[model samples]
Target: MEEIIDQNEHVGIVADDLTSAADGAGAFLTYGYQPLVRRQRQASVGAPVVAVDTGSRLMEEADAMRATGQAIASLAGCRHLYKTIDSTLRGHIRAEIAAAFKASGRPRLVIAPAFPTAGRTTVDGIQLLHGVPVAQTAYGHDPVHPARASLIADLIAPDLGRMATVPVSATDSDIGKHIAGASIIVVDAHSQILLNRRIAEITKHGPALWVGSPGMAEALAAVVGQSPDRQTFTPPNAPRHILVLVGSANHLSHAQYEALAATGASVADRAEGIAKTASVACIHAPRARTADPSKVLCALVDEADIALSRQWYDAIVATGGETMSALMERLSIHTFTLVKELEPGFPLGCARLSNGRPILLAMKAGGFGSVMTLCNATNAILQMGRKST
Candidate 1:
């Protein structure tokens, strides 16, 4: 995002994870609204569009509900409040939406979790992935929030309490006419035109509460009359090395890690006790389930020697939210200077160390990007560094 430091801003977003937050902010970034991705709530309220990552995707149901509810309640003052969910239907989607609905105090909650460009669509309230039910996709094996069914209604049946439900249809003359007086309306949007049309019509009367992925963010930004700017990018100076950290148990991330290993990078199983001499290194977290995720992550960070990482590594690419948070904690980094999107689901930027030096940092959602996404991201950071200074 470019210019979001003024008063009376338009959009505010609550994201469940870091990558989702970055992707949402990147949407505003493309449209010239300087977007800020904050790890903590209420950290970027001054900007025109603030995307906050609650980092609650892996929490227990009760904990996730409480955290999501608090996040939504805290952001009630924004002109347009948007809840960004993972397009793959991971995390506590049902509970989080219900929480946002209750906290926003709005009469209606319009849900459209489709990102057609990413092959995620909602037809008749069932979430389909690449024309197949999401339950049949690789996400069906997700460790944390395994999606066993593709029906949106079935997926969210637990938390959708007593609210009037409406399923939208594309053939309808105006989708907005059906948005009112409903506790939750699942809008069926398979394309940008439909999304923009429905969103514009829904909010035609006044402010609205929106829920979806980054696709919705882009559509909403466009609806607010913000045309994207044609901007050129400048990369940073070259670094000593590149480090890739894999933090998710998702099969997609595991495959990506294997792809990284195949590239001849020095790959290590545990992060805590690894010594590195190679220009490129990959630290792969465990694939098996752990009873205590936070403790395990912290131990890994401690063994990986994060304090010395900034000195030896020129660029850092992390694949999941918990991994990103652990790295930040070990390095004592609080804020990131978000540059722009390196790929569809990855945001490339820089974070400053206590020594005042900047290092390239790129984050990707666990299930997003291809097997080569990590390698490409690392190369992009290296290229950017070469062009800087």
Candidate 2:
């Protein structure tokens, strides 16, 4: 596909969580857009592409809608708008999407929540995770916001109006026919090629609100074209101390934490011991299935805050959105300047505390990374620090 350059086009991305917001913005980094992820809806935007985390997924349905609507409303002037949803169909998908649609005032809403790289796909309007219906996957049993169904149409609220489903094999004209009268259209995309084709065809229909995960962000970035001046990354000075915080209850996250622990990283028994005993220390929530998520997150944040008070770490790695969000809030950090993505869903960036101290941060969604992801991230952080010195 040929690149379409539009110097005046600015993109706005709205996500239900922080990790999603960072990864969504990180998608535009390849095209030379310096992306910024703001924790608040009204934060200043210094980059062409800005992603905002509404922190709405943890809210009740009504509050989620209000938060989502306010965030979209704040981004009213952006020429292009995208909403990021969980690829596995978790959270208040229906309510938040409805709010974004109402706020954007875009004539058509196109929904394609496929991330082929992660084995999430949509086929015949059914959302699948690794060839199994999402409702049958681990997400269905999520401690919070479990998915109730795999059918895309079934997941969306009926009040949103009739939705047309476009198959992967559908021609451009077939997509056009579906877009003409449908208020919402769900496209079936099982691969990168199919997803790209669907996005390319949809963009031709003029301005419409696009919805999906990071895969959709990548496609939109392509449509927006490469920037005239690509930004170069300058690795920050190596961190002398590193902290890994794991607050996700996902089995995958637990496994990743275990893998990192096996590498001999000290597991912190007390906040006071973190700064004195080890250069690399890990703090994780209990792995019991019956652990209360809210209490667990609060404990992690309290422990991290105490560690920071004793000594500020140069680099911190956090798993799960709730964990990262809670930590950032505790530090009074409202914005994250995305430098690069260490991996597809793992974004590395810098954030300033209320006292104006900058710290390197690497964040990942609980369910997204491999078992070795945390270990690899730690190694990468150490290497970056070493190269700079």
Candidate 3:
């Protein structure tokens, strides 16, 4: 927050979901940008970086594009526009980018859906997860927007008309040739090195619409001359208990929650409620995929016997955007202080009471993080809270 308080310049990011928006914004936070995620499609006032979630991953393609356009329209004055796509070819990928490009009024758009660190990359135009086609991985079973193919071009062919394709393997001269002629260029990047190089080349093409996941965002930030400060803060000691809420039906999220529960946290299904003797608790959402997830999350919050005013828990770890959004709404929390991210896709923030007492919150996307990410996040948040006090 101190890093961007006196700055007036802005960079904009448009995302399909809440976590992705935060992931994009988190990249800038390291570079001294006070990042804020706005739920509504509105103009940014004071934040140096504002990532807006279109919240259209599950909506119809037409509706998704419309929401995306509206989000981009609010970013009219931003010096640079970033369209954050899912590393995997999920959601209305092509449509959203098209909308972003159109609404942003940029001359050219460059797209790369790769995050090498997370094992999601584009090779020969196909999206691969840990060396396997994304369509062959656990993401193929996603309830909404399941990946049906690995080809990046085919994945978004429905909306990509005549865009040029430039493999990261292409020489700088070759890429430049294509970039000079095409309105949109899709690049193939299998590693961070290649992606960074491509970004360097793209940056040379002047002010175009840059699009990709967090990896691309980081590279773009560096291209724009933003370097990160790698200092850790020592938080003051505070008594902190935590509640881990699992509301996403994604297999990865369920596996992560199970891994967290295995670490001996008292596990209580929403129906069972929190146990009297449990200090750290896991509020498990129902396993049935057919059930209404929002309703389940709402019930969990409504039924929580804990007292927020008393600050019984030091932090609340929630998985999935919808779940976190619903939890915040039910708790009447409208704003949060953007703390540093725990991991690439796992962001932690602090919501506060009117009196400014902080309610520590940690969140991640449904398909992000390792098996132990939840457990790691819980410990990290506890440590962060203690160090900050």
Candidate 4:
């Protein structure tokens, strides 16, 4: 509380005892996800809760932070203690809430479920997890948590909507090998940097590449999608798709052309012209392989196929968990901000968003994974890698 006050920001002190102190401030006074100031003012009264736990162990760590917060909130008091949603950090929050519940032996623990703050988590179930006194569900996803809606309306003002596809060559193809008759047509305005990266990669493909202003269809002409959804899909499809090849003794034999040929997609027959015009919203489309999951898979395959391919790829193979982690570690940062811990290094692998908690990834594959299907792993790499470029 002091730190928050010192920082000169909204100080939200949770606890039945300190309700008054946080009066003008945001208060979980009612004890739930959104027992905001307005709702607190409108409501006549309510009970209290003692403890709460978020769902799932999640990599076994989400509960840590929650438990910690609960511990702190327990110290506050006024009449009620709002237990936040269940989260991996639930244990920590519970410890704090437990303290308050133990003191009051009946503080109202409310269910406040909503998308967690960018840096926070939500523990949907509060009363059951913690033996607190009373429970009040304020908000939820599908059911529309009333307490939650109240605050969001009071704060944000909600608006929502919407996908798109970039056609390669506009021409139709008669050949059976080609997925589409046209060339690659990428979304021009796509994440500019990523777009530029893909453009640069296509350029590297040399004469095999045919320019189409910018988009997937054009890029695919020069390359092939490695994932199931890249080109021909069953039914549902994604607009942005990329393809990469890493066969032939894992690049030792370096049969680049053969690798490109491995995919049966053919050139547009009687190909005339592809529309160069592009639209916005390309920002989210596939761009570049900043992490290179394919490289990781290639290394893994070559490492195992030594007798089959020998020294051809002895130097550039990575057929192991460490290699895969190294590949996705970069992009995974967006998913789990605290992901520097996952950077590939000796001794300790890296830290990643396991189930939900932040746990350091260790090498020497510890637990036995049942379906360690290499195909699924390959497809996973292809899916993530194609998005890179």
- Index of the highest-lDDT prediction: 2
In model 3, pairs of residues that clash are: 234-387, 235-386, 235-387, 235-388, 236-387, 236-388, 236-389
Runs in model 1 lying further than 4 Å from the true structure: 1-7, 41-45, 135-141, 148-150, 153-173, 225-240, 249-264, 270-278, 286-296, 306-310
lDDT of 4: 0.23
lDDT of 2 at 325: 88
TM-score on alpha carbons, each prediction: 0.82, 0.92, 0.85, 0.17
Question: Candidate 3 on 266-362: residue-level lDDT in tens?
Answer: 6767525555445567776777675466577776665443534333676778888877777776666655545688887787766664556667777
lDDT of 1 by residue, 113-199 (tens): 788888888777777888888888888886567776676665444454433333545444445456445556677767767777767
Ranking the candidates on lDDT from highest down gives 2, 3, 1, 4
The lDDT of each candidate is 0.71, 0.82, 0.72, 0.23
Clash number for model 3? Answer: 7
Q: Model 2, range 135-205, lDDT digits (tens) per residue?
A: 99988997778988799887667777678889877887787787678888998999977888889878888
Best by TM-score: 2
Ranking by TM-score: 2, 3, 1, 4
Q: Superposing all C-alpha atoms, what RMSD in Å does each candidate have to the true structure? A: 4.3, 4.2, 4.1, 26.5
Each candidate structure's count of clashing pairs: 11, 1, 7, 74
Candidate 2 residue 380 Cα shift, in angstroms, is: 0.8
**Compared with the true structure, what per-residue lDDT tens digits does model 4 show for residues 1-389?**
21111111111223211111112121121112211111111111222212121221121334433433443333233222233322212222323333323333332221122212211111222111122211232222212112222211111111210011122221222122221232221222223233333434433322211111112221221232222222211111211221122221222222322322243211110111111121100001012233554553444333323321221110111222333233334324111111111111101112233234232221212111222222222233335335644
